[model samples]
Target chain A: MPLLAEGSFNLLSVDPGLVFWTVVTFTLVLLVLWRYAWKPIIEALDARNDKIEGDLKKSEDLRKEAEDLLKSYSDKIDSAKHEVNGMLEKARKDAEDLRNKILQTAQEDATIVKDRSKNDIEQAKVKAIREIQELSVDISLKLLGNVLNQDVNDEEHRKIVLRELEKLKSSN
Target chain B: MLSVMNSLALVFALTLAQAPANNQGQIVPLQKVESGVSAKETSVKEDGAEAASADVHESAESFDLNEVINHHLGDVRLRDFYIMGYNFPITKRVAMMWVAMTLLLVILIPAARSISRNAAKRPGRFTSMIEVFVTFIRQDVGENTMGHHSRSYEPFLLTLFFFILFCNLIGLIPPMGEIAVKAGELFGYQFHLEPGDIPLPLKIWSGITPTGDLSVTATLAITSFFIIQISGLVYQGIAYIKNIVPAGIPWIMWPILWPIEVLGQFTKPFALAIRLLANMTAGHMIILVFLGFIFQFQQLAIIPLSISISVAIYLLEIFVALLQAYIFVFLTALFIAGSQHRH
Candidate 1:
């Protein structure tokens, strides 16, 4: 083939100088890039990946904390609502008891006052009737003396009047 | 898009159908034309393509596809560098390797600094872009293949990957020689360099793919081979020799299996070198071949089709360049991993 002909270019020909240079170039590149390029770059990539994973874990933890806080706050609010309801119920019951006690005391005082007033009326009526009966007996004795009627005694007259009044109160 | 496809199909059919017959007719003339060009280069070093009418017609009639393909794929010796009483001949590929090296240092050193500086913060676009490649080699290629031992081999793998990748990508760009020639034409001058007469500037700026050269790839594969063997020895000690053959085979089979297993070790790297060299070289060769069709047919009608196909192949070449770099490192990692274990 013309491609492999003598003095013509051979694609497979090995040039030792080129090989040497390639080796030198590649070795230098590997060393230099490893120090300045590949090492730090790779480290940075790892750091970034780690940072990402860490951030995700941190956020996850924060979300869980927030949920816990929410739950606790809701629980607190529920308890406060329950306490307020209990306080209201206790206040209403206490007010009802106080009202019932006040009504009982007022009714007792009113009954005592009414009974005392009835006794006062009964005493005044009996005293005033006794006084009037004695005054009528005195007038009858003075008129009998003037018209030939002799004075009757006070004790007998009072006794007769009280007995007759008692008979009349009973008959009426 | 359909027309482009149709035109490409027509070109492929025509070339495939007529290539052998056409080769039979033109082979002698093609060789003659190659010799003529060389003779012309030597005789008329300064005057560019000032030929007789008959010679022009002959040159037009014969275009050697092999010469064009080889010219692109083969290495050109630029000059000899004498250092410490030793002569080191610098080829285009050697210079390109240096270019790739310089490029890696220029682009990556700062990226490394930036990464180290802002390791906690999100990196900039450029730094992050480089980090993606470095991380891919470390994690995807290195860690996946070698597992925990990947860390130890990362620097080598990363260097191998970026170096080869840069070389492959740089190859796709138009070489300084071609660009210089075109620039010379625009200025009404022709830039022609006799073999070994490349200017210092042109030599420095030569843009060939180092990985496409067998010598370079062989060097890389040789390094990988050593690393693999050493890793095997380091992990398994001197017993690595015995471990090359799988365990549980009959003791009687040892005599037959040992040599083949050893040979398999060498062949793995051999395949790596050739695979890289061929893949990198073939893409450029195919592109040149497609473009060569235009001159071969000597018709304006072939230009569009040839260019379109070349463009398509060129795009595929870009993908192939990255893929081949990835494959080289990945396989090296696999080989290294394989050596570290018995089965």
Candidate 2:
């Protein structure tokens, strides 16, 4: 009680000076902080938010574009595979037709060569028989003439020998 | 946690230092009473005689708890500033407000620079921490309460929050006066002084909460009141005057309801001022009262109980300091928002 009386202190006593100082101090703090601190910080926060949102949207678009490209590439690969299969099928059919044509031509040439050689052998045999018969008629006429003292005709003997040889070939 | 420990140490040291000075004034009568009682006991040592002496002793020892509480809570006029032929008294609370203002400027200006520099990048730890508090004040308190209009008022709200917060937090730390006294005592220099005898340099960095002062809180509340009223007038125009009574009331009841509703506007800020003042003062009062118990009972057994309870209350005071600052700003924002709209 003595200290309170001596200091003249009261809990609810109003002090106008303290209030004036507080107002001045608070106003200064508000002005300094508002100018240097709050404005820039809020702007930065908004900017960072916008940048993040834009980056997210850009990434989403890139992902969709990549997906589209992948689908188109896969479609191209599928068509190429189909074209390759068709080309193989056509090549195989062409090779088969060429092979059949070559085999048929070879068989025909072998048959023709065999028939021509058979005809040549038959003509050669007929000429050789006709020449042998003519020679024999000349030698027999000469021997008979020497025994009976007379000559025989060569043309009629040759003709009669060729005819006999032909008859013999036909009969064989 | 270290600051809290330092604060506890300081509080204990302050109690120990003040104890002797306090005893010099208070314990002399107690000693005289004891001698008288002992002299009586030597002649006739009866139970009734001892009880009567104990009652007499209690009366003789004058430890005024109200005086101590008031002396600490009340503002001390440090000096007078003369301007324009008028004197403005500078008190301890005013100096404390200057301290809070200095701290705000010193700490927040650099933080603001860092934030602006790092707007496109991540900020440093300290800057980011400051940003977190600023963001909370803007987004949670200002934006949540006032919506888009909060942008214009964010500066005022932020200043109020930080200013009150610094004042409250600074009060929790032992005042420069106590620290100086304790430091002097540690070096064998003793000071036996009253609350007013504390020197100006030591007194300027006040340990007392400015918000604990009714004048200071009232000033802040008055500011908030103006902002609320101005916002109402600006947003709602002249209709704001009529809108205070709310809509859909009977026209006959306007005379009755209008006066009470008009008074409600003043009472809202009045409650705000008182709420902050009481909350800030109560914690310190409880702590002081608990510490006062040691001297009152003059028992060693009560020291541990008193100090432990004081420490508990001191910790609670820290929490209340933040909570009260938050509550003051949040309510102001709410009131401003409320005023701008009808109902």
Candidate 2: list runs displaced more than 4 Å.
A1-9, A57-172, B1-17, B20-22, B25-63, B84-86, B188-197, B298-301
Q: How high is the lDDT of residue B107 in model 2?
A: 92
Error of 1 at B129 (Å): 0.9
Total clashing pairs for each candidate: 1, 0
DockQ of each: 0.34, 0.35
User: Chain A TM-score of model 2 versus the true structure?
Assistant: 0.55
- Model 1 whole-model lDDT (C-alpha atoms): 0.76
lDDT by residue (A4-122, candidate 1, tens digit) is 12224567888778888988899999999999998888888899999999999999999999999999999999999999999999999999999999999999999999999998999
lDDT score of residue A152 within candidate 2: 46
lDDT of 2 at B259: 96
Report the C-alpha lDDT of model 2 over B1-343, residue by residue, as the tens digit: 8466546644653454343223322232212212222332233333344434455345325455654564466565667787787767777788888888888888988887777776778778898888888889989999999889998898889889999999888778766655565566578764444432444444676466788888889999999999999999999999999999989999999999999999999999999999998899888888878877766777789989888887788778889998999999999999999999998
The lDDT per prediction is 0.76, 0.74
Q: TM-score of every model?
A: 0.80, 0.73
Tell me model 2's lDDT, rounded to 2 decimals: 0.74
Docking class of 1: acceptable
